[model samples]
Target: MSYSRRKFIQQSSRGVAGIGLLGTSALGVSLGAGSGHTEIEPGAFNFGVASGDPRQDRVIIWSHFQPAGQHSTPVQWQVALDEGMMDVVAEGIFVTTEARGNTIKVDVSGLLPGTTYFYQFRVEQAFSEVGRTRTAPEGDIDLARFAVISCSSYAHGYFNVYRILSERDDLDGVLHLGDYIYEYGQDEYDERSLRNERTLTPTHELISLTDYRRRYALYRLDADLQAVHRQHPFITVWDDHEFANDAFQDGAENHNEGEGEWRDRKAAARQAYFEWMPIRENRAGGISRTLRYGDLLELIMLDTRIEGRVAQPGGVDRQSEAQDFNRTLMGFEQEAWLQQQLSGTTARWKVIGQQVMMAQRYYIKLPDLFGGGASLWLDSWDGYAATRDRLLGHIRDHGIDNVVVLTGDVHSSFAADLSDNPYDANNYDRNSGIGSLAVEFVTPSITSPGFPPVLAETGAATIMAASPHIKYAELRQHGFILLTLNRDEARADWFYVADVLKRSTQYRLACSFLTRDKENRLVSV
Candidate 1:
């Protein structure tokens, strides 16, 4: 258990089971995922179910079984508040061995509290596909709703924005700001990778841990990303194509010296992303945490790619500052634990799920032939300009108003309004106040690929006609970003899906914005 790619429970690859078995109150785990339990067999529960980091009570259900016998496969679980599996609150049994490869995570706890549940898993006569999770607000909650999404590249097409966010039943969770899966190989996307008939299975690139668990079981056999993890609950984080592209805590730009080691391919992509993400591990912080939701919101997730990114900053001197107060994205101990959870939050929204683009991205101009000052993307946060000026100078020195920042890895879509001034394009009236403290929405790309439809609407009309706190930008879209928050406002709509390379694609709503709870600004509604 000495490995720690910024913790999320890799426990040196698994067989953990003993957080007192999710103790202190785990009250559910029984609804029927076992047709042969204690010795299961039949089709072992195909790769199609998940639940995630939620807590007011608990949540973390996941699966992947496959064992006709090499021993250990018991499986059996259930947690229901009714999806017609009768109210069965919780029941358990877990085995799926091979030192944790057959996968299965349970962690369900004493439910109740802004509740909503329904889980399933089995092994003998097959079951799975139940999901639907909730459970975060704890006391006198106001509102929280989410749905935010990010780079999803399975051979560059058709996830139909996870089937229109799995026909939303009004989400209360789902953040996922990372290239959820994409280590790149197979036809490496030319003919849209031969028009996805569910392709990509170690058809090349991943670099072992059995090629990132057979490319995460070919992207969990996408049935619209297993119906958005069977509808709801996902709060994830892992930008840098989940461990490669601009990766940094030591090296990446697609690793070199023949990739035989980049710390064992970033510890096999952090042990297959904590054995298939449901994220809940902090073994002394670094996955960078925080979550509260009740009196409005708090989230705060960040690891800034590899927990202390360092190699970006050099796309032809993107912002020169050599040693600019010692570059870092969230290094200095996660920037002093994100300025102590944004100056000890009181929760009326303070989100910050983290990945990139914390607005201040400059460098427009190609009209009249050339010249656009630096900043285009030295892997964003405008290449760590003193950690975006000490996190917008600690949210303008702790006067921290509503503060949002939910970004994603640039698959194009933005809304800005976090400032420290600078891109003044002749004072385009960003309310002359000089530096609004915070507001950023970002999200777009569950089907990755940005800027082609007329250079993403002409590079988003030259960065909103030269970034005066960029009100909004789309530059070719894919989808995801519902986001509501209450106790006086914090909207964000943006949907999209005109075609993820066609699977009857359709989703719409291309815009909406708002920001008033504490008002740092940004209003397009």
Candidate 2:
């Protein structure tokens, strides 16, 4: 958690003055005649820097600055094509204020596409460490790859997976598909079963903006997470846990009648999320945006939480109505935008980056079971069957080749082929046939319970037998996925962390999946 003295100077305003190494004394540097030699101590501002929403020519840069005595101050940012700072490409000033938790976000633009740039920030007389970022490629690009990650819970285990992922130099970008931070208070969830679990810093549930910001700050303190953010540009989307558990359009399952108004809580969560995370404001138009990697790939990042979720149900039977095709995760406007993007895209692959799984999953009928049939978690695509079907239909109708759905929130790894009908048990063709659409790869949680005791005890055979579209499923384990995209095929490597209870970094390849040209089917890798 210690930053270098040189890094601090580079990020300070003094370094902006182009001062050479002065005589080293008690203070790091000696100021000239009228200049003060006082140095700003590191750790004054803790939240690390991040970049996101990468486009062909632009990407957003972000940092949260906390001045020693003042609430916050304006920090100047400079982006140079070279490490020597001889080729200054873009520069801007971002004011960090308490209103936004001293967070600053700058959307730097007008740079050459598919190029790497070095950037730094200056506050008063101190400058920050130089960070590197890359812009997306222009039209008809040759190659692209990204790491797909999600569901990193502090209370559940260590972040060794992040540490390993951070060291990988092959990724062009990182796609975080939600559940980046958990809302649970300390000791609320049991982690004794985990291997390398660590308790959260605050030891309390975050409900306010400051609490959430602090949580993010703590998370960024992890060396691995910081390295990963520093290593590649990130593209993110939020799932329910970012706001509250099982958050619908109007309210959440965790919100109560007396726990303030739902709108206020939702707004607070959204405000905190924007303040801490690297995302554009949730404007009225939509949170869906397209990132084109030249002609190679088009990543469509969607907002599935706020737009069209229905109110919480009164009972189990009432939940059945939640599946009304009209009850959407993405409102009509966003859905239309997605459909249009899919239809109009000329990229080799159309990647849907969002929360929740798209595959149709159902419970198997077991004779003399304790509770008969299993309940489908109403929060997933299972509860929005009609909308899921519609999306698949759109992909099929548009003949979108290499359409892949990257999802999270289930806290389990799932590889499936998107089919028109996955529930027709007697339809052998439906079971074995690869649908007209593409594939889906679900990354497991950084640390979340999966498969539970009962399901794990059953050996996952029943679940696999029930859902044929689900080609693969692993109820246990925690890790991230590395996706390599080529002109002819897309490959996903499931990196499973050995333990989440302690701080170990051991991992193994749980599985791999690949999709090739002409054949939208996903073959086991």
Candidate 3:
């Protein structure tokens, strides 16, 4: 029942039109008399191929075709085990039209668990890029690995992060912790006014569905992003940028009456998000769902920006009303669902793939004698202190062990421990009835603003000096986190590119951390 990678490739090449024929150099084309590269027709899949929301024995395959002006057309898709695309395991035909943007999304099922499958779409004589995707493993499993990334602004230099990530063949998939595409338009932010040719599109902030669609169009045009999508599935969640900066359920900081109503804008952004990304619809509360990876890891993907988040609490509210403990970021329904899942789950590691930092960060500006302490950010969980305290209290009360929070939206890498005493980060010594309840790993931005000047302009030493819980902080890096989880331990390796300005650059592993099972601690590797 077990198949080695060698055996899989061997079986795949047994016949012509094999997996290798799908267009990659390694799998050169063996189809008839055409060149190894057969350019697709204009009215075909010009944006490449992708798959996501992979479950055991099931996965979602997505492709977009331009009918030019046609109303409806039939597109065919197939799953093959061989490089030649011969040995067809499953095949189907789907209908597409301008109404759905000539896009096709198919949920293919009846496949084997923990199995790799290659798929492609045929629009008449042309073929969409062959996509490689694997289903999630079921029951007990030995190991799983994935790349965690976030905050990719088209105007902020190149997505060399995608290029580097696509080179990886061992990863199970990708976990995007939001900011997949920013809402800011051309020349919106002074920091985003880079010299990159791939500037934000529409020349304006996305407030309409059409605007959001065109924005996604420009982002998908990047060959690096396309290559990554064709290579592996992406499990994603949205952050504030998808809608607007500092977004809550009611409104956003960027939206104004002059632009449009906040509710309509939020709806447009949400619709575009689900339409462009290869994501499945959640039961309720939108985009908040849990994924079980065998028995080793359970990824609890949380939607912290929208759904039912309250407006951020300001300093006045914090001092005047005690910050209102009832104000929530995850809402009530989602919190209850998460509690139920974590309290009873059997997975060895429960990971929250969420947007924004959850760990407590303090501000310690020298008095006005130096320069007034800079304003602190309240958009993160720090703004909802009481809600965070409630969640941590629940974990401690229930004895939830091996909990790990993977965060984004800050554009920096951090390894921190969540203390049992939420009030004291430095006093988590396990003697004063205070100890670490969980650990968190924050992945840096892919191509967002490089902090104030460059990643973590304040320096890691300065940041850690304020928030002592963080064991390591790489503030000046634009990269992603590579995570490997097994039965006994989980390791996170940070990889950063040499330069985002260049189309191609040298990317190297910056550092690694090891978290022993149930230890709730990070050790530099």
Candidate 4:
């Protein structure tokens, strides 16, 4: 059963009395004496509350407020130690206006490291659902667990995976590896949109600012998505669908000449994303940043979709064209930044959170009149061969140990070893984990479709058989990955849901793999 916010408020209201002052100190006073706002109202906080981008002392909390006939409104927010708004630790007032889509976000600072906090918002007599969040730890720590997820299309299916993850109490945070929301119109992406009772709000492709805002509001209205946001803090980075299909730095594949200017659409998409998401924005509008969790792990989030991607090469010679040194996926600036982060970090584990698979994947073809050979998937790292070579070669040369790559966007799950040349038998051993620079785990999509069942299973086998370094692949399931990091090893457990078409919590652990400390190869656990 889904745990609605209404039930949570009603259960916690017994200890509260009424509203308090605007800037309340850490006095541990109970708020909301007679507010009686147990349920959601039409014009106030209808999209729900969320928190993200956690650090040792701060985290960003967000919500949307739009009261009728008003262009702007002042909102009160409070953070406490308990579910009941009694043990107040921090409180403030922020103004939300029509220009920013009426979204409210406050970066609550002066927080204790590794502490869990419960927060609430208020406007006049209206109260929002209570939210729970945690700050990142400092110094040494033993273990940390995170849920890696991406690609949630509203028209595809119900958000059962989000609901299931929300029910869990052990996760430190959720790593959203992009595609938080899609830009497609009604019936554009999924044929079962009507059948699933899930429909897009704007009913057309997202081009303007309002269209993107409405699309985000539609996705956030789901009780499960709200529940997950209410339960745990999120660390997110956007992918192609967040803007459009196959989006690069300047334009996108789904974008056409009829849809006005690409720069305008891109700006609108970025504005709406910043307004809806709880991430901290930089002056240059770059989403690539580093997140550290004590001495245990340092998560380097990369923007592989829109920040600095060249248009992918096309036609039969695309593979050869991609080998050009000028072509880049993360741009030159981000690549330099990533190199500094990798070589300078002192954390036990270096984890990369980004979109797209990093391993080299190729499909073999039988010899024919045209002299058949393997074809590379240009959309992924295979398109930027030299770029990938530089990154992996750095790890191999610098001896960066326990480097793990967590990826999404393929709508499938895969476990593969990152090697300079997996096909070279003299250097790399398929059985003993030799000559491997790192390992990558590609997470499955939440609702986006994959190949048919027969093809998914058989094709996975074929790919693994051909690509000896790829140890595991599951294309038929839809779910997330639980990544646990400690001193000994970093383990990833693949969890799959029973169905996405219906609201169900039934799920199973499909497989498990781990790479020991100082060892780059994957071992089934």
Could you report the Cα RMSD, in angstroms, for every candidate shown?
Answer: 19.9, 8.1, 7.6, 7.8
Q: What is candidate 4's TM-score against the reference?
A: 0.90
lDDT for each residue of candidate 1 in 342-406, tens digit (9 for 90 to 100)? 88888878888988887766675332223323566768877776788788887887788988889
Off by over 4 Å in 3: 1-41, 192-197, 283-285, 318-322, 364-375, 420-427, 430-434, 452-459
Per-candidate TM equals 0.36, 0.86, 0.87, 0.90
Q: CA lDDT of 311 in candidate 2? A: 59
lDDT of 2 by residue, 271-381 (tens): 777877777664663457888888878899988777676653347564455456677767777778889998898888888998888776667423323322233655676
Better of 2 and 3 by lDDT: 3
Lowest summed-lDDT stretch of 10 residues in model 1? 18-27
* lDDT score at residue 147, model 4, on the 0-100 scale: 97
Q: Rank the candidates by lDDT, best first.
A: 4, 3, 1, 2
Model 1 has an lDDT value of 0.72
Each prediction's whole-model lDDT (CA): 0.72, 0.70, 0.76, 0.83
For candidate 1, give the lDDT of residue 281: 62
Worst 10 residues of 3 by lDDT: 12-21
- After superposing candidate 2, which stretches have Cα over 4 Å from the reference? 1-43, 84-86, 190-197, 312-314, 364-375, 425-432, 452-454, 457-459
Which pairs of residues collide in candidate 4?
A: 17-32, 17-33, 18-32, 18-33
State which candidate has the highest TM-score. Answer: 4
TM for candidate 2 is 0.86
